[model samples]
Target: MRLEQWSRIMGKLAIDDEVLEEVAAAARSRGVSSESLAQELLLEGLRGHKSKESLRQLMEAIAAMTSRDVEQTDSVELLREDRDR
Candidate 1:
């Protein structure tokens, strides 16, 4: 799942002509081949997906913690008390 752990695995993707044109233009602007640009975009997208999954997991954890019967305190007051401690 990490870029450093990635190996050269040949795969084919069918991109729409319009999208390919956009990718080609982007690649030309960056002075790289379309294939490289596509790979970079795919990696970036995968990283973003991983980040989103992490955030979702964190939210679920926060939800579980808050679902307890403990009384909720004012966050600002709690921070102030902690800071003064």
Candidate 2:
């Protein structure tokens, strides 16, 4: 942990009263400040969102790499001709 991490920056956050109460209760239960708990939750949400975005990009790249164009062909005639040989 860094010394700057423990220092609070000057900013105001607007939160609903009910949500604030819930956060306060959770912080009390965990023996940490409500601000710290809120910060941790926000960080977790950001990480999860980034992971989902990375997975989506990877899937799109894989699809593009494996995609191919197909040409029309006479399947029944080709099979019959092959069987006769």
Candidate 3:
């Protein structure tokens, strides 16, 4: 189920005193509501993880790649010659 398919709804969450204090401090530092701070923090943390999954999927497609798909960027022969000098 995706968000766009839903009727927009506000959900409830319960935070402990310790967690709420951290949120409050973050909110003050960022000049935003604790709710906004929490949402931003959640998105920031989760977005990187979500992109890594997509990147892993893209990398998996390399199983079908031929030699032409590879672009050699290393200087193995140059390094070996330089080393023998």
Candidate 4:
């Protein structure tokens, strides 16, 4: 691990008291700091969002492929015609 990875940059984050309590409890349960728990949750959410975007791109590509006529027709006949030439 890099030295920077171990360093924490202080930043002010706003959360309701109930939410803060929940995160604190979760952190305690996981044996990690509240800040670390929050960071982990945030990263997980970001990764999920990225996965959604990738899925959307794949869906669009599939839709595009289905929208077009891509199948080759009369393959044997075309090959025979070519061979005759």
Model 3 lDDT per residue over 29-56, tens place:
9888766777788889987575777888
Q: Across residues 1-85, which tens digit of lDDT does each residue of candidate 1 receive?
A: 2222223343445566788789889999999977788789989998767577889998999889775788889899999999999
Lowest summed lDDT across 10 adjacent residues in model 1 is found at: 1-10
lDDT agreement of model 1 with the native? 0.75
Write model 4 residue lDDT over 1-85, tens digit each, in one string. Answer: 1223334454455566677778889999999987788789988998767577889998998778753666656789999999999
Query: In model 4, where do residues sit more than 4 Å from their true spots?
Result: 1-9, 51-53, 60-85
Q: Which lDDT values do the candidates have, in the order given? A: 0.75, 0.74, 0.69, 0.74
Model 3 clash number = 0
Q: How do the residues 1-85 of candidate 2 rate in per-residue lDDT, one tens digit apiece?
A: 1223334452556666788788879999999987788899988988767577889998899878753685546799899999999
lDDT for model 4 comes to: 0.74
Ranking by lDDT: 1, 2, 4, 3
Cα displacement (angstroms), candidate 4, residue 50, comes to 3.2
Error in Å for residue 54 of model 1: 2.1
What are the clash counts of all predictions, listed in order? 0, 0, 0, 0
Clashing residue pairs in candidate 2 (N, C-alpha, C atoms within 3 angstroms): none
